[model samples]
Target: MRPPTRLARAGGALLLAAALSGSLGGCLSAYLGTAPEENSPTAPPSAPPGPRTTAPTGAAAVTAAVTVTIGNFLFQPANFTVRPGGTVTVVNGDTVEHTLTAQDRTFGTPPIAPGASATFTAPAQRGDYAYLCTFHHFMRGILTVA
Candidate 1:
């Protein structure tokens, strides 16, 4: 048989590329974290595992005046209330260290090691604030200043 023409070879390459792109698109959920730059080459084999999440059952919401717990890879009482400019303490119950990284830079804390505690002063704006563990950066929670 005659070898394929140059036009035929180009068409085959385009068909192969289309098929590969379609397959990769279906696996986007595996990369659920913050989307990086479009041309960045630092992606994982799968959607680099995300943080463990939990809904606030009000479990630690009332503990010892605005104290929350960080243990078992979750933020107990995923949300809590605080007075404007009041203190919000985080008590770490896990062996690993954690942080209360303010998403808005309103407040933050140094590392709170296992069985330790750290406090962040609530913003004075009477609004809800979001935060996460700088260490985990996925263990998220909220603080409401009213």
Candidate 2:
């Protein structure tokens, strides 16, 4: 065959080989369940177990405090459940100011001073109440009265 014709044939063979190799590689990967390097080998550990509460010893049982920490513009216990008419003392340990305003019946503290504490008694009904820090819109929490 002429030089030009031979060169064209060689180029076509190389192209066909490259295409076959790519398709075979894809099929092999799918069969082996091999993922890219970034894919984690195993699912990351789940979040630590739920919040742990210290049971009241003696008189403390009568007056239990469900502390809702406020820091980094977040409520540590973003969601919590409490017995109706129970007492919830929200302590603001953050350096910034925070407020706990109830969505409905004004069942919240005025502005809990930073490094200071304030308490609010739940109503006599069962419902989910959302609270937030008016000063910082991002700070929010939920109180499930049961």
Candidate 3:
């Protein structure tokens, strides 16, 4: 093609690329948890991957069995009430890796492999603990100690 025509074609291609990038950036931002609308209260949050709180006595003092399963980017139960001295075992049921990390200086299990399990003892006090998968920051849960 003539030099002038080729230059015009190249300019048109560059403009198309810029437009595509701008639109794609917005979609990528939403996927990366940067969307204010997603965090808004009007949007009901998903259930945590497991219970946030554990009993004081762990599972032994409770009448019901307490087991939390982690898998498929979610925590089963997502929330639980436990005694102060309770013990909670986290079961990693997902094919991918996950962690039972807790804030507030509470106990935590190491990164768990699929089909592996980790147990943590509850503190001798009532409080709430939030946890999530380290790899997938969006996966979350809470343990409520009573």
Candidate 4:
């Protein structure tokens, strides 16, 4: 068959452009809806794995401290207790960076790189303190001081 006329070619190009734009718009919306935010209160289903290390500082330097392990975007022993003003050591066993941040802003750790570790001191007050990973908010745990 003979090649299409110029008008036909232009029409075809416009149709293709429209289709691509629609698909791309849909993808952008999907990403914005699903991608996690820094202040998000939920965690993704999983995280990639890798290895890194960080030096323990502040309360983590204390020899006597309770251990909290992070893996699979979940905190081990999601609930635990410590003495008021006690030291708590956070071990990052996951392959991604994470944080143990108190909801009340009373205590929190720096971003603990994968396979790295950090520490924070428990609140001196007697009560339950809820915490979560600042990066992955869904990864949460409870710390009680009594």
Candidate 5:
């Protein structure tokens, strides 16, 4: 067969470049933690792979003084109550950095790296405070200070 024409060679180069760019884009997104995981809130819930916490059985057993676990892009014990101005511990169990920020600016924690932890004091006021992860807004929880 005759050698490929100039147009054919250019087309092949363009196709190769497009494929390389697409693959690089995917790698970058994964590295930046922008790629959605299977357990993301937008997807149907699946059994998380790890030890799980059981809900308290009685009202008296309920306690917000426990540590908040972040994994699978979710906040375990998504709602709880604590004493006013009480310090709350947040554990980042996911593979990405996360922040627990109050919607009303009452309380928040700086970015907690994966497997790291941080703490923030609850507002002294008695009310329900909604919070979310600054990096992943869909990951939300409620803090009640009573």
Candidate 6:
């Protein structure tokens, strides 16, 4: 058999390069997307940005710590509400990992390995917030504050 010609070798190299760049592009986007903007300075520490309030701890303390479990390719209690200024604890009940991501970029968790959990303060407002498991498109949920 004859050795590959220049054109063939160039084509192969181009294909390999394209494939690598496609995958690496994804990685770069993910990293850049999550990184804080270098040009945008953070807000003053004395003045907090969002309507951050302490999670209620009172007669509603028992209900204040809400839990959203992830398993079966689903967010158990796919829809639920909690009082404003409360805590939402996302528990990964599945054998595989999961993520609790807010569509509005208001909040989210890094990958929660199986049986692990992440907790964040609910938005201090009275409205509906939609979220999803970034890893699983079909896995979604709603958080309501009223």
Candidate 3 positional error at 64, Å: 8.2
**lDDT score of model 1?**
0.80
Mark the regions of model 6 whose C-alpha exceeds 4 Å error after superposition: 1-62
Report the CA-based lDDT of candidate 6 relative to the real structure: 0.83
lDDT of 6 by residue, 1-146 (tens): 99999999999999999999999989998887755555657633354577868656454533566888887989888987777778988999899989878898787788999989998888887788999889897898888777
Q: Model 4, which residues run further than 4 Å from truth?
A: 1-64
Residue 68 in model 2: shift from native, Å?
Answer: 0.8
Output the lDDT of residue 42, model 3.
83
Better of 5 and 6 by TM-score: 5
Where does the lowest 10-residue lDDT sum fall in candidate 6? 55-64
Instruction: List CA RMSD, all candidates.
Output: 13.3, 9.9, 11.9, 16.0, 13.2, 16.9
Q: What tens digits encode model 2's per-residue C-alpha lDDT throughout 1-146? A: 64668889999999999999999989999899775455566855557799889765344343334777777778878887677788887778888778877866469887988888888888777778888778886777788776
> TM-score of predicted model 4?
0.56
Top candidate when judged by lDDT against the true structure: 5
Better of 3 and 5 by lDDT: 5
How well does candidate 2 match the true structure, expressed as C-alpha RMSD?
9.9
Using all chains and alpha carbons, the TM-scores for the candidates as numbered come to 0.55, 0.57, 0.54, 0.56, 0.57, 0.56
Residue-wise C-alpha lDDT for candidate 4, range 54-133, written one tens digit per residue: 54434444334589999888998798777788889999999999999998877999999999999788887878899998
lDDT of 3 by residue, 36-106 (tens): 57768887787769867844564555422357889787888787766777777889999988887776547
| lDDT against true structure, model 3 | 0.77
Model 3 segments more than 4 A misplaced: 1-65
TM-score of structure candidate 2: 0.57
Clash pairs of candidate 6?
none
| Model 4: ten consecutive residues of lowest lDDT | 55-64
Better of 1 and 2 by lDDT: 1
